[model samples]
Target chain A: MIGNPQSVAPEPSFRDFSKLCVHTITTKPWSVEEAAEHFAMSGIGGITVWRDALANRNIYQIGQLLRDHNLSIVSLCRGGFFPNLEAAGRQAAIDDNRRAIDEAAELGAPHVVLVCGAVPGQPLTESRKQIRDGIAALMPHAEASGVRLAIEPLHPMYADNRSAINTLGQANDMAEELNSPFVGVAVDVYHLWWDPDLEKEIARCGKNGHLYAFHICDWKTPTLDLLNDRGLMGEGCINVRQIRSWVEAAGFNGFNEVEIFSNRYWAEDQAEFLEKIKHGYLYHS
Target chain B: MIGNPQSVAPEPSFRDFSKLCVHTITTKPWSVEEAAEHFAMSGIGGITVWRDALANRNIYQIGQLLRDHNLSIVSLCRGGFFPNLEAAGRQAAIDDNRRAIDEAAELGAPHVVLVCGAVPGQPLTESRKQIRDGIAALMPHAEASGVRLAIEPLHPMYADNRSAINTLGQANDMAEELNSPFVGVAVDVYHLWWDPDLEKEIARCGKNGHLYAFHICDWKTPTLDLLNDRGLMGEGCINVRQIRSWVEAAGFNGFNEVEIFSNRYWAEDQAEFLEKIKHGYLYHS
Candidate 1:
């Protein structure tokens, strides 16, 4: 009876997701130690820190917090913003991304997530080609660092100036083009829920060994702002459980990393925010 | 050499776009004749009127407006809202949709566009089934009306409340199941641009003879509002020209309906709104 795949009941919530990774932005103003302490207390398995968050705290300090709190660095907060106007500018972006790869390696992180940049000063397609070239240039360094480069296809709304790689298919194509063991994509539900071919594309990526990471978040109804109106899991319209099922079906066994950019979340106390996330993980997700 | 397909370059300026079709909502408070009059003065090829816009003005009046303004109705505003809890409720949707079809035919519209309803207060997949059933029910009536029912797959955000058929692929699947000449999908750039398999889906629609209408509009970057904040074609970020090229390639020869739901545009004078659409028609397309 359990083998009935067409069961229409609401999916069971994962209450004891001890391996949940709290994104740095989730505890925006919290110090690294504070975040680590909160993560440790929550029984959460890991933390995802952004480059900006680590700017004030040295790597040793950040590393020590992770070690002391027993927090695994699920993935680093990204490196790719490749497109640029001039060849030198483009080269500059490549060099910077190479450093990000190195930083991810130093942090003992599994992947240096890439937000492949959008068209610099021209059209989208041309910028996409440049993004491919940027990744192709940085792939060897990423390989050398033993750090996977996870390309994130930002929403199409960000296609002009944020990230031109706006679809998993497009990202998978680029990853295959680069032909690198280390370069893949970070499949974020917030960015990808609208994709009609997501399941098929995820399967394709799985076939190519390119689906590196998965980020989970709900898309709120009457989305107030495109960038920050993200809903907590199960609060908004997205079928997060359905998406999770698809991911699991596609052979992806990874962290259901929460990455919210909601203004409402940031204003709350860090502990409250962390607690809400933990609660959201409990009954909502 | 000119026999070769003209790749969509930047279109001419809006002032030069003597050819256009004013989608009625651009001027919210105006009558269909008034909107048609506006279209005529601006040298528009057609005007798409909402059901409300047609309510007070009888079909005879609408037909007279069509003749007086030399205006063509590309398609009617809408018809389908299929899924519902009760059988009668579902039947109500179909009956109303059939009424819309009759209205479209009376007003000489080529298609009675269907915005298939979402979960009749249930799961997305169930709503999808309901949508399929509703379409099957309406097919005979739609065929009798001689008005094509174009199923418009809205953006995925509306999957819970508005329409569960949120992808062109899903729409195509339903269209195939119906296997009738009366039902298909409308291709709106705003709803479909984020789609990874857009080109493939467009091609599929073309092959299946289901590409009923093409809607052109930009997706605002910060998209201030969800249902509204649509960009004037060139002013916002969507690569309209590239998409138009794909639509054309797919053999969809029809009115390129400009459907902008921007609060900013709505605030502008109606003539200038039409003129702005003309600009959109011409440049940054």
Candidate 2:
């Protein structure tokens, strides 16, 4: 009752690479092609492509390149910055999201992760409304393209300008209100590990059949940068394995996407970092 | 309903400094005597004494000095760091908290704010239990000394080691569970502003008569340092005045305590910083 607040399932054994996925941004030093080659060589199971990694590239060709390496295409990294002061700006964000969905569909990716947006000076309530409206506007495009939208709740630290959806409960509220098979929530450990309502909310989302994607990372104690500075699994305090157990118990049988944005790790030899990720995935996660 | 999720009260006019309180640590460069002289000269209404500011000084004399300046001695800055992995360490924390309470009594402050502690890797649930038990253990002495304890829920960013209590609702639950007249919750906008449930929780704590203190500060956008990069009111996106309105509506007519820990502000001239604080207090807050 004190520590294990609920019946948290024990960690699943990682005997193979079937469930391991890596975000392209996690290996910043490597180009998409390089990441694909290295990831395939490392026996990485999947790859979540960031938009930046696909710049100036042919979406279909890149998709083929990844598939040729036997890397499963997970969700696209992001597509949401919906809150804007001006009407035109909001429209621009929505239009950009449509493009992201189109790209994901072309790339053979099943879903696009949405980092629901916030404006710094705008009231969070207004921002929340805008995020909901933005997502609703995209539902048609998403469904038509056969691409799902996963609402990824950011940490409270990012509530200012990153995302008004700072809790899984808030994300669930929005997703349920929207009510689309094409709309669901992404569970990211880095953003949600500290939430006290995590287990209960995970169960709620799972029961509602809204859990779509699961992202994994750790939170360093003296997190040097708000944007970067995430720890690799087993390098920080987050019980990634425990959270994974909860995610699995919630009926999410998805890739454990290692979506780190650490300047420290990115500065390292990326191949070595990939090796560490494998070790962490096998042992820590 | 989109922007103002509930009926948030409008900002109260800051016609005077009668309700303004400044924490000593806010002016980190100043000695307690220096802070007292400057604060009184500026017509600041109250002072919350941080423990470090009273080091190796006569507590009774400092109390007399503060009173001599016609300043209201607000609650002492802190007391609790209750959670510890070792029994002896936990006892040491309790003993230190007792000393903090005694210091508050000597300084003529009403309550000692509790920054309930956490071990870096300790499960927050376990740390939470330790925090509850620790506070419950200190109830007798707290009652005997006629000193109150305010459980200050820190930001989730500090959930790693600073404090396990990261939400005002959690603090309210603990205060209600403890069922002590000597124990209550401190609502700090810097910590609780991002919470979607804040307005409801504030109202809940107020209805239960568990609201003890209110601290004010801004949360910067690019929060460079987790501990020392807090923004001054109006300099960031927090909408401090609006939050102040909510607290006032919740029946909290306590001092609007300015508790900023900013490396940017601290590096400036302390006197000029005090002027800025006054300006921020009147116009922004």
Candidate 3:
């Protein structure tokens, strides 16, 4: 027998969607206006909007629409790339992230997911220290805005050029050290599912109330490209239900926000893209 | 002053190699024969042999040469790709690895490095369990040959289709569970240099005396190919000296083998490659 009560339900019903926020990136086919309409149509609990898509509309305009649609922004696109040898460069990154946090707050985002940068012109160890301090510095502004800073630990492959924080445990450590409920971790399945300490760390994050946002995407085995080659849920090799169970077991009741950055999927029609997202949701559920 | 007694020496002489044996892999440019001679010439300590260059020279020949050159074979190129879905395929891999273990014993290798294979058609969590069990089953034969099994946890990038064991902590956990001094881990700087829990894990391994082998290679930014693209010691960003120091500090007096699987270096003249190996010894001393 399957573990989850939801999984035991026979025949996928789109009804009772009182708890499911589908991410906009999953339906990259839809424009910002179209996606907001789609989320309303699907009766999803909420939605996540990307900065690029939001750029088509004014931030204030998008904020107004979400209010009208009764949609909740689980998280804003991102904010932290704070590792550079140059002090000026590092400051600029922090400033940019602060702006992002403000934007997230403006959009009524509960948390601003931070892919806390990489080893910029230095050893990874030193850069990691810089990233830790960077998050600490950003916590005050985030707390004041009522926007929690969710440190999203990217996959270890991105440890060099992307985010040095590669494990949930490491992210939790930073959150615990900050000792602010305002600071926690964004548990992205694509990034953290492979972690052997995942079960232990997720529990720790849950106990600490450090589990901020839950992002979903599958890891394609032949992953041709590092950055953009993400898979649709259940299409690749990830045990999504298993990880979803872990997150849910850890007291997480957030949306399994579908976020795929695939060129193959991106090249498809917007309607087809939305169709695929719906398919992923229905099939996985 | 640094923690070690002679830690202040300029490069080579000041290096605290009390608990480290140096192993040479010619990411620099040397062939297998050339590396064997260099291991003898450098007076550095042990080595781990790759399968490619050794393919031309049979396993028996490899053992004889290691004996002739008076080099300690810290480990054999690797043996675990147990996640293949097909039973015949899985058995084939096991058979090959068994041969690898025998070769390790023939060369007096203290350990056989294992790149625990990846998920075939199942979830990584399941395959990971299979990998651990695979090692456990193979342990009896390994014990008979007097060869320790060193689980080399690959980076998370290789979780699918490569090696499921993607962290030092994971490898240590397997070693601890097996409760055999014969089964342990190989800490390669290229793969594990970015681990945030690395210091604690290294100490843990040291105390367990499970630190079987230490491999060295730099991580290049914009790493073109995941498999073949590795940096030469001092040429790339990783602080090799710092990692070397950490390994030594951890109670391991084993070889710091340089295993660079770079296509660029492989094409270079063997003498030039040998010089760079010597240069790395002195430069990254």
Best by lDDT: 2
lDDT per residue, candidate 2, A166-257, as tens digits?
99999999999999999999999888988899999999899899999999888887889889899888788888888999999999888999
TM-score of each: 0.88, 0.95, 0.86
For candidate 2, the docking band is: medium
- DockQ per candidate: 0.30, 0.67, 0.44
**Ranked candidates, highest DockQ first:** 2, 3, 1
- Tens-digit lDDT track for model 1 on B1-285? 233122343434434333356688867756777787777877788777788887766886687778688887788988878878788889888888878888888888878888887652266667888888888887787788788888899976676578877778888988888899888889888887766678899999898899988888887666677687788887665677778888789888777788877788788787877777876777655
lDDT of 1 at A8: 33
Ordered by TM-score, highest first, the candidates read 2, 1, 3
| lDDT (tens digit, per residue) of candidate 3 on B9-54 | 3445654332223343454355667777766775645667765556
User: After superposing candidate 1, which stretches have Cα over 4 Å from the reference?
Assistant: A1-17, A120-123, A194-196, A203-209, A249-251, B1-19, B85-88, B120-123, B194-196
In model 2, the runs with Cα more than 4 Å from the true position are A1-14, B1-15
Q: Tell me, by DockQ, which candidate is best.
A: 2
The per-model lDDT (C-alpha) reads 0.78, 0.91, 0.77
Determine which window of 10 residues in candidate 3 chain B has minimal summed lDDT.
B15-24
CA lDDT of B44 in candidate 2? Answer: 93
| Residue B266 lDDT (model 3) | 74
Which run of 10 residues does model 1 chain A get worst, by summed lDDT? A1-10
lDDT for B137 (candidate 2)? 92
